[model samples]
Target: MLLPRCHRIKQPASRSLFQSRPAGRLFIFMKRIGLTGGIGCGKSTLVDYLIGQGMCVVDTDQLAREALSPGQPAYDTVMESLKGACRLEDGTLDRSALGHLVFNDDKKRRWLEGLLHPVIRQAWESRLHTWDREGCPMAVVVIPLLFETQAQDLFDHVICMACSEKEQLHRLLQRGWSQEHIQQRLKAQWSLKEKMDASDGVIWAEGPLSSTFQQWDQIYHRIVSP
Candidate 1:
């Protein structure tokens, strides 16, 4: 976690017009990095490390949860659209029930995505732009479905977490998901290799998290270096 000082904060050659001056600080390019991977692939660990290093992050999962809370636009929309099918006895939306409904049917999955993705995307992108305007040097957006959602254009760089299938299943099992459930989730998204191939950077996560951090540190310097 010992990242060197990004004193110079150089921009990559391909990026354009991100450099902005802020009083006495070094000119920093507004960086919006997308962090993504399969479920339980340690994106949270990386996000914690980024926060520790003073980077702002928008967690789309958190935003999606907020959207489902009562009085939110998405909550009202779902009730009107789905006719309370996802509702619980106490009147709260049954998240587990909704999840089960979606995971089994491609139509349901697309319907849920259609309901929530736009709101979540706008929320995070607006936050990132606001931070950039306020002189934040860099920010991260943790989107587990970044590729699936076709949101790669929203970032200056996308860093994907890659690991063996065995490791991915092991981590999910630790979270109490069954193998059948894991398979369902996996089938819905691009494989780890495909994500890595499409990403600007990949953090190989077959080993310890410190190793993952080490890779990020290297990518950090590479992306921000002269």
Candidate 2:
């Protein structure tokens, strides 16, 4: 089902993601794809696979992490906003502590998003522009909250990685997350069903690793070959 469910590259990426950039920059439009899903849904694995296939991938989570690292502009802003609530002894952000802070308090989470989302989006958009100018054929941006953040415009096609909630919880637990921690994080994002319904294609991430990846490989070939 996953292999047969490939969605082709759609035309006219949402302009909202790059309205600020100059127009008519690229002779050939770079095929931009958005990869999104719930937390612990094997997005990293898919990203690696895509990267091995020579795709330029922009992982927004990694962007966010780098943005909030010590000495970064957003790092200063977060520390100032949180009054140094979860900083480490080395003056870097204590992400685990910060996660606990934001996950438990909706207000703080929203505030953090307000501060982080624009910066991350701008960073990736700039990269997309770069790739297009460089004549890159295709690129993927991994944004877990693509639909929730209204960032679908950032890509020509959107793909969702989905597995059962039980499988999701199991994956998180393997990562040393407590049941409560898993629940708290999952509650913040749209459910797998909702994401899959909204995406142009869905990668049902169940069963063996090879099986999951075979699904993604088919979708990739369809997008790039079509």
Scored by TM-score, the top model is 2
Off by over 4 Å in 1: 1-27, 88-91
Pairs clashing within candidate 2: none
TM-score of each: 0.85, 0.88
Candidate 2 lDDT, tens digit per residue, 1-226? 2132444445445453232226544354578889998888889998988888788998999999999998899899989988998888899899999998899998989999998999999999999888977778788999999998998865688989887777778889998988888788888988787788788888877789898789888887887665
List per-prediction Cα lDDT, in the order shown. Answer: 0.79, 0.83
- After the best TM-score superposition of candidate 1, give how far the Cα of residue 147 lies from its true spot, in angstroms: 1.8
Each candidate: RMSD: 5.4, 4.0
How would you encode candidate 1's per-residue C-alpha lDDT over 24-50 as one tens digit per residue? 554566877888977777888888898
Each candidate's number of clashing pairs is 0, 0
At residue 42, candidate 2 shows an lDDT of 85
